[model samples]
Target: MAFMKEFHDLEIQLEDIRSATNNFGDENIIGIGGFGKVYRGSITHSHSKRQIMAAFKRLDRRYGQGDPEFLKEIMMLSRYKHEHLISLLGFCKDDGEKILVYEYASHGSLDRHLSSTSLTWRQRLNICLAAARGISYLHDPNGTQQRVLHRDIKSSNILLDDNLNA
Candidate 1:
């Protein structure tokens, strides 16, 4: 909970997140991974007073990721910034629940569209290039003394926006 003080601006109430995701209903789920399911929802920013679509990653302890992993993710994402990287909007840690909120990727993950015949070769190449740039940034984050190594890299993890930008 000491981290909460350090990331006060990034703290989201559990009540708000639950209300946004409809209490994590199955209908709201957009993706699932080793950690847990990702839910799509609209949340109102406390400061901006504007509603925005977001993806909520609810941590499931049964999946093996605990507090340490969750904290590390928050730390890394909060520190690193890139156009291609998924933006961390905020997080919730209350009532024994751990959740990460992010800007929603309208086009979803690349894996879902890999077999689409409508995708042009140029679009695919652009997506790859953007993802590579993001990876490179992580490996050598600007103005940081540390290097980040993403152990997982897959189509499912490469999200795309409405413009198909990775």
Candidate 2:
């Protein structure tokens, strides 16, 4: 418990998460993956008292991820910061729940827009470039000797914002 104190600012109460996500209601579900379901919700900052839309990834033990994996993800994300990389806003680890809160991508994942006729060629190129940059940063983070390998690299893993940037 003492080790977790380092992340106090990034720790979010489970009650707040439940409230924002309507108790993890089906209506708020945005995506489902191996880890679990991702819900779209809004959480009010404890300090700022400002509400922000976020994506909450609730861990499902049946999916194989547990506390160790959850902690690893939090540590990695907390250490790394890049424009194209998804931002980790906060996390919930109360009541036997492990949830990662991320900045919401209004446009959703890259795979969803791949088949759309509305996606222009330039937009697709830009998305690819942005994703590449993010990957590059992870592989060789600035001023770090450690090389981070993203075992999962897929269109669905790449999220896009309102501007179609990945």
Candidate 3:
């Protein structure tokens, strides 16, 4: 009873905040998609000492309120730890706004590099190998198919770190 009321109140507050936020695509939006806009943010409220950019995805209300895929991804990622996979730092859910906070990649998508004249054949081959290995693990015979489908396979999804490796 009390919890429900609290949740409802929070939902209303979130909607107000969402509405008040700047037009996501106008400036701060680092990425945009059919479901939401990913904005860049700082780590002021978090416990981390090092400052790294974060991807703040605000779910688009036009699609529908709340996103099941986003929730499922966060819920599953919360239970485990891995290197190849991107970690979902946290998620904020409310009546109208659902935000997913993630570590931002500085180099942008692998495709951006691959499409450029600088990407050597060796680098492209390396990326292919890395992605194949990831897909194999996700599609392991013993593992359930739906656990991590890797359904959205694109050069943009592959992120490289400072060392130029996945």
Candidate 4:
């Protein structure tokens, strides 16, 4: 994939990514979706040198989305910054490997909670509002750029923070 100019600063060395993900060990896997498997790992902060949890999405070489879609996602993520959206920390494209790094959603996917326990009326409402706002922000045509259509929307896609705030 030919990365655009915007990818220059966000490019993460494949070695670093590999190290952070412990070579993508099975234990690191947190979820699996249509594109690839998502892993939980910790990378050292650039400035603080402290370990920070991160979600490492390594695209499957054989069955995952193509380079065009991957590149498009990187482009879109690099351009958009919203509070409700997951932050793209960086990406890796090397040795025929494609990987994306994002902020860790501590509480995990919303679906995890739905089946395990009963949510209070208030908690359910908050989850709904947050997901709606995120979708609304992505679909708003009045933004500086064109609206983004999220092809996937489901309980599993709705990540939650440490506080369970969607």
Residue 149 of model 2 has an lDDT of 94
TM-score, predicted candidate 3 vs. hidden true structure: 0.70
Which residue pairs show backbone clashes in model 1? none
**Candidate 3 structure lDDT:** 0.60
Candidate 3: tens digits of C-alpha lDDT, residues 41-155 = 5553245545666667678867664567666656565544446555566666755457766666666668778758877788778767876776666666254444566678887
Per-residue lDDT tens digits of candidate 2, residues 46-106?
Answer: 6678998999999998988788989988888877889999988889888889999998999
Q: For residue 5, what is the lDDT in candidate 3?
A: 42
In model 3, the number of clashes is 0
List candidate 2 stretches off by more than 4 Å. Answer: 46-48
**Per-residue C-alpha lDDT of model 4 across residues 95-145, encoded as one tens digit per residue:** 988888898999999988986556777888898999898888889946577
Off by over 4 Å in 4: 1-3, 46-50
Q: Once model 4 is optimally superposed onto the true structure by TM-score, how far is the C-alpha of residue 87 displaced, in angstroms?
A: 1.1
- Residue lDDT tens for model 1, 97-120: 999999899999999999999989
**lDDT accuracy of residue 63 in candidate 1:** 89
The per-model lDDT (C-alpha) reads 0.91, 0.91, 0.60, 0.83
lDDT of model number 2: 0.91
- lDDT order of candidates, top first: 2, 1, 4, 3
Worst 10 residues of 3 by lDDT: 7-16
Error of 2 at 122 (Å): 0.4
Provide TM-scores for the models: 0.95, 0.95, 0.70, 0.90
